[model samples]
Target: MNTTPLRLLIHGASGRMGQALQRLGSEADSGCDVVAAVSRKVDARVLEGIPQFAASELHGVPEFDVAIDFSLPQAFDAILGLCVARRVALVSGTTGLSDAQKAALDAASVLIPLSWASNFSLGVAVLHTLVERAAQALPGWDCDIVEAHHTRKLDAPSGTALTLGEAAQAGGAAPHYASLRAGDIVGEHLVQFTGMGERIELVHRASNRDIFARGALHAARRLHGRAPGRYRVADLL
Candidate 1:
């Protein structure tokens, strides 16, 4: 294993996933350093000694190996521009981007290594793979995806849920989605295939937010020093 630590920048350093990354990435075994962080409003207390800057202030920040973003979609363009300018790799988990915004990512991917995914949990990735196989084997079944998250989660049918639905579609099944927002549910996704008196369900539940934080860190390690290209969490798996 390469022991050289990766220099890291976080785009949404004040948010849930961002804080999680800061906590977990600080460990000596994580093989990375939280050199800097970016957010709309800089919060020194939350960020501790790590430097925090606003999106517009990124021009003055030092270069880092890779950036992990969990901020709003609106911040993506700015982050992409910064990453491209610095020749930095990027990993983004921001969801609900418009087609044009996604196009911007595609354009940037050509200049630097980038990985984008809706969910970073390894279990969720496995669940997606399993859903594809089950849907392929049960052609006659009706499929449905139900996902639940904390009430503060902005996007409905969490991006992971949609990805699961896409996997089902790829396997020749049309799936409907249901989204639920309740108190403090870390995350839960269930894909059900129902047929005549028989049903199969593939489920993944996240009890803590650290799973995503760890996954993003893993992707950042894979993205470091890689050639320019668009990548996905599935690729890491």
Candidate 2:
């Protein structure tokens, strides 16, 4: 394992998640050095000790091992292009991407390593594995995913829930979804597999969004020096 800290470029640096990642990346034990930050707009050329660049100025940023993106869909393509152009890895958690944008990721993965996920909590990654296994074992089971999040979250059957549904579908189980938005819940997902006289429920809950940033940082460290390919959050573990 490389003991040297991995060099990271934070995309969407002005957002809450971006701020959290910068904070953690600044820690002595984070195993990461945030060499640069990129956002859709730039105010200060530098902030909190890291160099900053606007989306339009992406090509001007210093080289980095991996780019961790937590921005909106509008800012996704530029950073992805920057990483591919630089031949580096990329980790993104931006949701609500268009089909063409996702297809672009598939095409780009052939040249550089990349992992895009709806949720980056390590626990959620593990739940993906467990849900797939349960779906496989319970051959004829009915799969249902129930997810709840803060009322401010607009999308029903969030990106995470849909991703989990995809996992279940991959295991030969048809999946359904139920979404609830209430209070200030951080995030919750329950994948249930029901068979004759029994049921299995795989669950993961997030109390804070920091887990996503931490997981992306972990992924950045793991993706360094790997062959070009598309990877999942579970793959790093």
TM-scores across all candidates? 0.95, 0.89
**How do the residues 1-237 of candidate 1 rate in per-residue lDDT, one tens digit apiece?**
778789899888888998898888888899998888888887462356677888778777777899999999888888888899989899999998889998989999899999989999888888888999999999979999999999999999888898899999999999999999999999999999999998988889999999999999999998888899998787875
Instruction: Give lDDT tens digits, candidate 2, residues 1-237.
Output: 458888899998988789999999989999888999888888898888988888888899987899999888888988889888999999998888889999999999999999999998888888888888888888988999999998877678899999999889889899999999999898999998888898888889898988888888888888888999999888985
Give the alpha-carbon lDDT of every model.
Answer: 0.89, 0.89
Return the lDDT, model 2, position 28: 93
Worst 10 residues of 1 by lDDT: 42-51
State each candidate's clash count. 0, 0
- For model 2, the superposed segments whose C-alpha errors exceed 4 Å read 1-3, 195-198
Q: Model 2 misses residue 34 by how many Å?
A: 1.1
